[model samples]
Target: MNFRRLFAVMLKEMRQMRRDRITLAMIVGIPVMQLVLFGYAINLNLRGLSAGIADQAGTAGARALVMDMVATGVIAPTQTVNTPQELMASLRRGEISVGVVIPPDFERRRIDGREAVQVLVDGSDTVVQSAAVQLAQMPLDNSVALANATGAREVTARQIAVVSFYNPERRSAVNIVPGLIGVILTMTMVLFTGVSIVRERERGNMELLIATPVSRSELMIGKVLPYVGIGLVQTTLVLLLGLWLFKVPVRGSVLDVYVAALLLIVANLTLGLMISTKAQSQFQAMQMSFFVFLPSILLSGFMFPFAGMPRVIQWLAEVLPLTHFLRLIRGVMLRGAGLPELWPDVAALIAFTAVMMTLAISRFRKRLD
Candidate 1:
């Protein structure tokens, strides 16, 4: 309660705090880092989504409609494909989120006050779908009304057919549940595996393993095989629960889902092995695991729409294994997407796993040194 003593103790604590540079930097730096990251990364404005237009009309009104869509700032005109098939192909490749197919008679109809345009949106993204629908409709009503007002005779207004494929209802669970599988796997698989080799080193067992004849690659694989099976079981349980509890539809082959799941698990596990090598103790391993886990959660499109983020943040999110896996799982579970449709994500996971395994094996040494 003494003021003098309180000041003395405060000064002493301040000195000690200054000496603990890591903790001091963490206190000031971590908050600033997160604030900058979250501030710039979080965006609700779904603007400039890549779009392809199939303007069969090739006329003035049809061109006006496409320009109006771009003016809405929802769908950016990225490609001008000649056929609906080409537009759909771009959608399937995930190249474009919005596809506008102007019918052959679109301009004639708009002139005659009976315009009908087909707008196909990739509904895999709930937020983008909603935004696209809103912006798409905003311009549509004006165009429709204008068509009616400008017509020679009393005629019907333009009609925009907004079709949201993959998730027509815009149900959140249909999008989140599949991504949850990746999130859960990333959390558990990374933390548990992160501690695995570190615990051995801390407990004086790594020395014995080093004395044995096993090579590093062999040792790494041996450690990972058991976790692979565990990963499969965990994936199955989480997926079943999602299906039962959320009625989350599995649109693609169940086998394909698990196949991708297995590959994703291996990728995460390999990254954990790399973390385990640098961590000197179990606590350090856990800290490192979370350091990796935190980014995967926020930036992986697990919680928010990926396209809603700035382009740079989207590229950073691409670095995380969870991002690709979430894409693959969501595509398979919600869109019935096959391997051909999802090969890029599959390839990303494969490349990531290979790189992490190489790093872990290189860093791993059996000796305490």
Candidate 2:
């Protein structure tokens, strides 16, 4: 090893490395992003979850229990409903994550040494379910906290019946298998659509497309529309496999799932069209897809708690279509939720599809540049 030759080669490599700004940025940026997201955004000690309370008990003791729940920063009251049915309605609307249904005889039963209260937890997100279950008992664990806060005798958290509504058994497969539908769709749809235009350009098909009477909007839509059927077949196969192999049940309305699934599929297909327009070559298209794909995997609540992330990170995730679809997939498979309960996710996906379709049509170039 000659010292001079080694130093000269190192200097030449350094100059090339300096010009590769994207690689340098990714090297530094990816790690920093992982650190920040894993540290600040992934919170295990979740607290202050928004909850709806139906204090049918309507007694000083019931009110005190609510206060204790709030003070512990475990379950913050978002709204108070008069009946348990109303509370369930609030939950289905995604208005709240936790529901407390205190029976009218809660106080009487507590004094009589019997179960009197129930906690309904939204089990769509496994992380939220776990935290909510742990905190549902605070009123019982720290009964002393409410000793002076109310006139009725305090009860133990054990007496509080914690019912995880969606994925009741808290099975890992139950939560993950449904979510995989969205993740897999995002990856395949985006990969195919992203490279479609680039592949056409490379094959000299752009000239043929330009000579055709089809407008840019029609052309783009035609390219992506077929994926809708493919997505349906994939969704059915995956769901059937999950049911048979993993014993993951679709407790929700299957019709609702299919409808929502169709909308979600179209939205993602349009997103791929938009990516196709931006990428000039297959390599560039894949690079762009990874930029979207990696974040979708990390921030979409597919792997972590959407509610557990910091407010800003959660807001950032709103732009990713996968984030919304995960909720729909999970809600359908577990919550047995109908369209009324899933309107927000549907609305978001619709908005995404509309915006991306418009953008793709407008940007789609006719020339092979």
Candidate 3:
């Protein structure tokens, strides 16, 4: 073996790695972080759903029925409205997932040998809604038992019904694919952009480019555009695979998905640029990108339902760009929601891109200060 040459190469490699310590740490840290975070974070099962009650009966028996429903632990009644219209309005506002209404004749119907009760659910979230509806069925089951006990003719009461709005099929793919678009785009954009910039810096060529008349903003834009193209390609690949292989239906306009992809691609590239700006070496940039990505996949409602997470974790998820991106794509693709419906997500993505790009530029312009 050429020991001298090998030693020289080894020394140079060590120097490069040492300068890019953050990348090294990210490389070591991200995999472990993902393993731990995903293990703990992705929970498909739901608990503690926010429910609304419309108790027009306002009687002791009616209150008792609502209490029985609450005891199931799958749902918690957050408010009581006086009418069904109020409950529906609350659902539109996302104040509650399930709405239960007990008519004024609730108690009288039981006494008069009749049955009347109903449950309304948004059903946008299949897993959680089903769990809420299962709990809401408690009152009807109780009525059945009471009627059997009273020796009355079995009354097949049909007033109680379960309504599922957005994804009535409860298709897992429908719920998952919208969020996956964001996750994959973010990961690909960040990885490619972050690592590519670091490679340029590490190769000692970045100084030459900086010495040129190319302004920092122009240089940054130049560095980001190629990765943006790559991200769009990846987005297209994923969408095609998802549609053809997974057979997940595309319910919304194709333009919506494309628009969402473009925004997310830019945001993720900005995030990657931010990581690269913070990192002195290519490997370090990769590490930070992976670290950011793990929590994104786990907490961004991609693999798990956000409602199932603890309140603190949900709050944590709110800061992540992927969280908002997922909401936008899911709303468009699954619910056929329009810009008015997904405006918050678009606004959040825009803000995140602006902030991340500013940070990245500021850091990149700082001369090792």
Among these predictions, the greatest TM-score belongs to 2
User: Could you give me the TM-score of model 3 versus the true structure?
Assistant: 0.77
Tell me the whole-model lDDT of each prediction, alpha carbons only. 0.81, 0.80, 0.74
* Candidates in descending lDDT order: 1, 2, 3
Q: Candidate 3: RMSD over Cα atoms?
A: 4.7
Where's the lowest-lDDT run of ten residues in candidate 3? 152-161
365, model 1: CA deviation in Å?
Answer: 1.7
Model 2 residue 187 CA deviation in Å:
0.7
Model 2 clash pairs? 140-156, 140-157, 252-336
> Which structure is stronger by lDDT: 1 or 3?
1
Show model 3 residue runs off by greater than 4 Å: 1-44, 52-62, 77-96, 101-115, 122-124, 137-160, 244-247, 250-253, 366-369
lDDT of 2 by residue, 1-369 (tens): 899999999999988768765456666877787888788888767777879999887766677667767777767788988898887776666678899888988767776657777888887677788887775556353454454355655576667778887667778899899888888888888888888888898888889998988888788988988888898888898899998999998877888778877887888788888888887678767777777887898899888877777789989999998888887777767766677677888899899999999999899877666
Local error of candidate 1 at residue 108 (angstroms):
2.9
After the best TM-score superposition of candidate 3, give how far the Cα of residue 184 lies from its true spot, in angstroms.
Answer: 1.2
Tell me the lDDT of candidate 2.
0.80
The candidate that wins on lDDT is 1
Query: Where in model 1 is the C-alpha error above 4 Å?
Result: 1-29, 140-158
TM-scores, all models, native as reference? 0.88, 0.88, 0.77
